[model samples]
Target: MPPFSQSTPISNGFSPNHHHQSTNIITIDVGGQLFQTTKQTLTLAGSNTLFSNLFNSSHHNSIPFLDRDPELFSILLSLLRTGNLPSRSKSFDLQDIIFEAKFYGVSHLLVQSQSNPSQFEPLNLEKSMLLPLSGRNPPSKITTTPNGSLFVSHGSKITSFDWSLQRKSTALTSFTGVDSLLALSSNVVAAGATDFSGLQILDLDLGVVRETLNWDNVTKSSSTVQGIGSSHEFLFSSFESGRRNSNSIVVYDLESFKIVTEVARNEIFGADLGSAIPSTKLNWVPSLSLLMASGSHSGASGVSGNVKFLDLRSGNVVWEIEETTDCFADITVSDTLSAVFKIGVNSGEVSYIDLKNFGSYKSWNYLGDARKANNVKKEGLGCKIECHGNQVFVGKQGELGLWSEVLMGGSKIGKDRIFRKNVLGRAKDLGGNRITNMGFGGNKMFVTRKDQQCVEVWQSSARRF
Candidate 1:
């Protein structure tokens, strides 16, 4: 929708011999602009890629990318034709080009878009990222894979990436309302829909999906499946019972694909509907074998929420901690645990919670330090945080704030935050983009952006590594 015009396609300028062109030549219309190229180039990225499949199928020659930009696709075609990335029309964005390259399955183009120094000047910030990991429809859920890939859930799909920051695979769900996502294995993903009836298991590579959770058997009409978490062999879903038996947490055995236990119920959600119900975003920490849930939601009186530690074996509350904050945006568990959430509903403030370990609930008093952002009203959004070494990386919808000084240099947290005074609150703001979500794996970081339709991946520079 931004003002951009298509450049004369590079393919139109190329000339080929009659006999050679007759058999392998292909033509396609992109955004009303026509392009012609050889089938060789189209099938070069032959394995499971869009082009390969497109050309190899019955609908090869007349493929339509009507919604996609012709100039960006031209840049992509040029990138594949010549290893050197072609110049853009200046009206388009570098991020947009990067996304087009990914969709067309040009792997090297992603590296070029991130590594090219010329493109880096426009949106300058402190360098911890390479380019971006991916571009999707606002990926709000991110999880690290067993092999260190980043799995992100946004729109109607889940996109996966390896540590190299290359997008390995993508999975889609039939349910339009996606609530939560969990990476169950290298190739399979588990997703739950908004109303608890649309739970699914998706196979990433072949794009096969099986609805693993039966709504009719366990769920009533009012039940809502808020979030999903997983242990090695088990899956846990937070169920909000609207009118049925007390609100509960349900567990499913992954091996048998059957309902194993009703983990915990009334104890956690004692109040019936109309009364305040405690919300805990479900996240399972594999190392500790504990399902971690925490959140703060607004109430009639004030903000109310809790950080609950639940036992997987017996469905008991191992520990619980309360907080006075807004709802949690997301939670991730690694060597260290980090949870990104907002302050109060209309405060336009966000916080990052850090936990050393999932030990005794009483001893786990660690909390996220808050940061205030500027240029936003009461209805505006807050930052999304990702855990890095000792510090949490902050990104709002508009820009990235790499404020290492905010929570840096402290080996352990104190009662009050140990601010890196000289550098505190000073952040390198990377402008002109809306960052929906970001994740780190090995030295690579994946950033999802709104302007682009692909995930941008950043490989760490020597300074950050």
Candidate 2:
């Protein structure tokens, strides 16, 4: 709230005859201050909200009164009208606005206004803040919610931060170290560890284990979770037996938590490298209705990997790509670009395959330094690659690189599509600890570095305030 020269109330230009001029006009008294807006504007707050309830009961004879901060109400009213916060809102604290919005039952409106996915700009992102964690263990895995809330697992504990990044809580888990963490809801998370048995569904708020999901393998040993992912209707978990002889991707109903079916069940025989590998990454491609399961294994021969596109309905591999030379260090699928991207373990260069025309391209299309394809130094050994919106983010060592598709009108896509790269962050933020994990939520990118014991938040500068 800004200081005023006089104690005048903030109001729209509505006079005594304003209601007569427009029947849609409605007046609201907030903390003794008068505010006027249209019924249609209040309806944007959604049904059952305070504003919506007021719209239903509003009468021209009696003005609706709300016992709340006038300044905050004015800001929210501006948000309701403009689908964004006004420049003047920069003067107020974001937490105050969030609390006030919740009171008015318009918290979702505020989230949409502030963290809408359309506002994510790869070029505009910069290191905004650092969220510190307890203990010496760095973040092993991290997950995020659509509303921008995040859950990070370090050692045996998981810390959660709300969408605003203002309030946070910590939860202790049963795992020795959480290797995989997925946010099922704002207050619930599915946590798994490679060395621990079963995927634990935890309640972050109460710090309790809600349930444990496991794969009943024939070996009769405990099933260890390798990766966890979710689509709209189902949750997928890659589980390997304690004996490391068998692995499978188990699918469960997202709502009921019941076993739906299993896919990619592989039994390892003596020295069978292909059947021995287990999926360490699971990504759902909603556009094509396929689940991308990728994993790599290092043997005496060299680093070898496989990327399989699995059809959940039929439990069959729709497409499979064998990675023999210069295998992927990290891989991700971008639904927006309709492509599968990977960072080579040997070359350390970004390569992508067009999913739309899968048969047109026989090999990976290198995005940077194709000459380094034969490099034997394993330049991309510990890198992490992820996609959010249309931009692809690659974390190599301590540096962040952004890959964006350059749109060309009336141009072919598979062979002629152009992609450009840009280095993210400033000179000071370029190098420090090696990046270990990266995830996206809302409009922000969450990055955790090796031995950092903190999560770095990268967001657009335009939305900083």
Candidate 3:
């Protein structure tokens, strides 16, 4: 996505498009930081010596440059005094103020920044780095409820918050031992873990546990539920066997609490002795009841991986998209249209396969790869793609790195555009920490860093076009 244009005026009175404000502000100390709240009561840090020298030296300068913007300075002061950013500011520069607030441990300012888009700069580097530092603890998965509430899962506890109200609701502690939880719908939720003890379902409305299906006796070994997807009546859990001898996708009827069908590689694809087997990643289309897509190795030993489209109603493989291997990463289905995008982590390529064209002769094609042909001599990796709406956002890593999106048909007419937005690139100290999970809801994007305690939430006004 392109960075939002700078045409919008700073919500605060002072604007880059306009001259400085007419107020004569004096410094006051609040929350251990010096900020100018008004002309009187000057509680300047370090004393008048520095201020006098600064004022005298900068007299010839066009605009007086304080350490930061005066409005942000006043807002920070109000936050320090009352634990809230002053809601009265006419213009707010979010990115710049947020970084300062995070560094200074201004909790209220951080919360206020989430709601006001006018405060935000288009693509600010300082604000992006300071986001994960604001939260008290890191979240494993962060999801926004349909009503615009932010729900964060940490360890076994899930907490919900009204971001606009700045209030945290009661915690849902029923999922004590579960490793992960996904909101299936507005009222239904599912959680799973690595102990191979099956899964747990909860009714969010009642805040009570509805069901817990144990698979310990059936599987006879510990298994990690890798992925979970749901239809209207049924919930599907995909598991990789703890014994490493079996890999299967098990379907369960949520209403009946029984395994309706157990799909294994051999049964689904009819594996041959000499053929290559693919590793399996299960995904379901929410609108289609019996439709499920599995990316797996086509051979017995997983030498060749391909995506298989299956019909769960008959427990039969209906179609297969072949020739690709090692296909595993973030997958998203367009909420507004009929499209599915599979982002390849290692391949640095995005294969856009249309669901409508699946059964036809020309089904799959390489939409594009980040690594150019001429850059084959370089040792570095390319970009990662995230499909949202009609655009596919790509994040590249480097000091001068960028995030761009390719419009679906824009590439063909030589009108393919690139966004100049910069994402939170790879962090140096986060050992073994990769981009674990991501999701989009409302107008916000949530990203979870692996092994980190907090999730980063970015608020944007731009919608997928």
Clashing pairs in 2: none
Q: What are the per-residue Cα lDDT tens digits for candidate 1 across 1-465? A: 223322223344456655455556666667877676767777655577777765765254345444677777776666667655554534566556656767877755445433443332211223444433244466656666533567777677677765344345666667564667777776777776655464678777778776556433233555556677777678777766554444567788877668888765653345443223534467676555677765555556554566677786787778666654343333334334343223333343444434543343332222332332222243224446554544445565555544332445555443344323111111542454766666555444566666455555544333121
- Candidates sorted by lDDT, best first: 2, 1, 3
lDDT of 3 by residue, 1-465 (tens): 111112123356556645443233333332334433322222222133333433343345433344554455565555544544556543555556666655444533445444443443323322132133233445655555433345566766665545442345434554444455667555556776655455677665577778876444244676556556666677677665565444556788867768887664432224342122322344566545445445433233332345556677677767665543434343445433345555554454445555555465253334555443223222223333455444545443322222334456544221133333444423641223455545555445555665576655544323111
lDDT (Cα, 0-100) at 437 in candidate 3: 48
Give the 10-residue window scoring lowest on summed lDDT in candidate 3.
Answer: 1-10
- Which candidate leads in TM-score? 2
| Cα-based lDDT for every prediction | 0.54, 0.88, 0.48
lDDT leader? 2
Residues 375-414 of candidate 2 have per-residue lDDT tens digits of: 7889999999998888889999999998988888956367
- Each prediction's number of clashing residue pairs: 14, 0, 25
TM-score of candidate 2 to 2 decimals: 0.93
Clashes (candidate 1): 14
Report the Cα lDDT for residue 429, model 1. 29
